[model samples]
Target: MTHRISCELAEAPLAPGEVAIVGAGPGDPGLLTLRALSLLEQADCLVFDRLVSREVLALASPKARRFYVGKASRCHALTQEQTNALLVRLAGEGRRVVRLKGGDPYIFGRGGEEGEVLIAHGIRFRVVPGITSAQGCAAYGGFPLTHRDHAQSVTFVTGHRKGDGELILDWSALAVPHHTAVFYMGLANAGTISRQLQAHGLPASHPVALVERGTTPEQRRVITCLGELVATIAREGLTPPTLIVVGEVVRLADTLAQPAAQVAILAEGEIRDRVGERVAL
Candidate 1:
């Protein structure tokens, strides 16, 4: 029951003074790449985010120094500038530093920005990509991002607005048919997302799926339509780390879903009562 990598294709060890910007894919330790696991095992210092699962962290070197720099809406353990500076200082100290992110570092995880800071300071670093939330959520939620009959293309969007300002995105582009749109950090703006897409020509009854805490044991998949998206979230009490998937492909979940003990699937007109009381929609 021991898994081993062949010596011929063995990963290079993380060197001293080198920063490894690694992705800890979508709350599932099993989804981690061999390179990411190797780097984590070799890392002497780890600066990680909130979404990086505890199970993933437990795989790292027991002696590694851990720093929590998780960011949530309106709350941050450390600012982006401070995190960048911390990486620079850690690398300067000749430590095998790992800047672990929740999903693919480059996709909305701000790995590019952090890399720029590292380069500016003449620090050595390497990026190890992880499976982004969109892919993870789609697969685990029993929906495909693209299908020949449903969707031809997929788009990833950030649902977070800039400090009380409106979400300024190309509505016409997003509301197109035969396309899947996955929004990250968008739980707060569910109403706006529902309205904008509708205004842009997408019907109110367009299929939508909300995957909460995707890829984790507590994962919940809520199946609803664009018009009832806001209400669905409120009724389900879905929280942050949820991914909003809007497209016809979401309807495929009814037939394609794989049963899981921990996953709860709630579809329109048929919702499970998690609490003691049942409230029909």
Candidate 2:
């Protein structure tokens, strides 16, 4: 099977001894940018994260060497230091390397830290932006991040805590009305998130949307209130990789959601099954 991509801006090749830190988007291969695809096809060494979908990886050249450096809550295949060293070493060997991260590399993907390492070692690299999980989950989960009547501002927050420590954040600012707050990797801190927002100013009845494995065939979206976030997760058996969106904008999902179940069925049945067949020729 042979495939060719035609684009006027495809002339810039991945030069040897350079690294391309590319975002793999939020699970969906179709969400990948053309520049990201180009680099994947040209990469000789691919370093990828856990959240990066296998479908996106399948689009890469089969000849490329793959290294999985996925990091989950408290479980890491490779330490951040080791991953940094690996990238530096690979680029030093004159390899066209691609560091594939889930969602936008700059949006809490640790691409900035990696970029700093590359710069310190004088390694040439480029960053290709992809759709962040907040955007992907919000769109696919059938809600707008911001609406004229619901929310006027949107904020992205990290839900990760340090060794079970308290989540230190500006609850006063976050609890303001007419603003949407999206928490990444926040499933574990649902109780704290709910409490803090209410303690500051927001009501317990604030609408919250829990999107599990968002933008994928297995995606699940649950609408609840801030007070019930913790209980909702337990009841629904939700896990990590879930996003928590807190705002009135989530109410729109009742009328706007395209039915996550149907979307999953179509993605698994038609899209996933036929993507290779259509693109292989």
Candidate 3:
């Protein structure tokens, strides 16, 4: 069977000496935007991070120069300042540089800092927004961030504190009723988050969803109450790139979740498959 390619990108090619800070979306290559795809194809150099999926990187031109500058928790391949300087230097070299990030660069991806440096250096730059992890993960995890019966508002916050210190978030505000809170890079600080939220008035039995590798074929959703947030993560051995969604809306996953069987593995002469069901710990 032959498949026809019918995508029509409506953006002009990125000019030389220009930098395009594009979001690669949350782990799924199909979530990439048309402008981002165009920039990837036209870029002379691609600077990507660890969270960017290999599938998305595969969409780039084969001749494009690639730079791996991924920063993991407690480990740094390239410091933020170093990355900023590199973008400046690359644009100075008159290359069409594509600085690709895992999610929307403006939301905790630090695109603003890089844009600041670019402006100071008088380099031409553009930003292409991509679906944030909260949006992508919540959708694939089968939960709505906001619903009339569950949540009237939604907020996204970073759980990575300076030096992994105390997360200085508005716990009182987040504890309000009818609100959905999504925390990025929150798994390590899950204990603190749960404690603070409960102390601030969110009940211990409040619904929570820990979505691991969300929006990808290997996606895993662990449903648990807010009281058991940290314990649930330990029980499941969940890791970074996981998103924490807290709200009454999370309870809806019990009915809305889809199967994460796309990348099942055969182990020990047995096929371990996760059926189309939500796991509650």
Candidate 4:
């Protein structure tokens, strides 16, 4: 079967000296959008991060100059200032720079900060939103972020901070019942996150799902509860790129989730169609 990946509605050719800040979606290479795929083919320079999957990076133009500016929890390949400066320098040299980030660039990916810097420097730029981790992770793990029966709203928060600083999240608001709370980059702070939520009045038995390497072949959806979150993570040896989803909706995973291997084999059209319908609500 000829799987024709269409670019019929592609955007205008990427202009020289313009920065295209694109989201790489979650780990699945299949989630790359037509626009994001087009930019990868046209970019003169590709700046990507750690969370971006190798399969997605392989899609970039062979002639494109690749620069890895990935940052781990405590280790940064290039400081934020350095990355911003690099983008400006690349543009000044008349390069069509593609700043690819894992998940949606705007959602906790610091695309906004980068865009502000570009604007300050009077640089032309475009942002192509990708499937945020919360969306991709939840969908791949087979759970809804919001459900009329389970949750009324969803909140996304980061669980760790630079150096020895603690995560300053509004636990009281997060502890509210009938809502979903997702913690990005929360694996390391699982103990604190679980403890804080419980302390803030959420039931100790509150449902929690730790999605590791979400939407990829290595994906592991560890179903547990708030009380055992820290222990579960340690027992499973889960790593970064794990999204922590806490709420009653997690219980639906047993019935809703199709494993990543199963989902990965589906046609692109089928994947998009199914995911689109779920997200529209």
Per-residue alpha-carbon lDDT of candidate 4 for residues 1-281, written as tens digits (9 for 90 to 100): 42434445556778899999999999788889888988888889999999999989988878999999999976899999999999999999999999999999999999999999999999999999999999988887788999999999999898877789888888899999999999998888888898899999998999998887777766667788999888887877778878899999998876776534345634332332122122210
- Evaluate model 1: give its TM-score: 0.91
TM-score, one value per model = 0.91, 0.92, 0.90, 0.90
- Residue 82 accuracy (lDDT) in model 3: 93
Instruction: Look at candidate 4 and give me any clashing residue pairs.
Output: none
Ranking of all candidate structures by their TM-score, best first? 2, 1, 4, 3
Reference-based lDDT, each prediction = 0.86, 0.87, 0.84, 0.85
Measured by TM-score, how close is model 2 to the native structure?
0.92
What is the C-alpha lDDT profile of model 1 across 1-281, one tens digit per residue?
53543323355577899999999999867788888887888889999999999988998879999999999888999999999999999999999999999989999999999999999999989999999999988887778999999999999999999788988999899999999999999999999999999999999999999888887766777888999999889988989988999999998886786555223323212333222244322
Candidates sorted by lDDT, best first:
2, 1, 4, 3
User: Can you tell me which runs of candidate 3 are displaced by over 4 Å?
Assistant: 1-10, 258-281
* Model 3: per-residue Cα lDDT over 37-104, one tens digit each: 87888889999988999888988889999999999887988999999889999999999999999989
Q: Looking at model 4, how many pairs of residues clash?
A: 0
Q: Residue 83: error of model 3 in Å?
A: 0.5
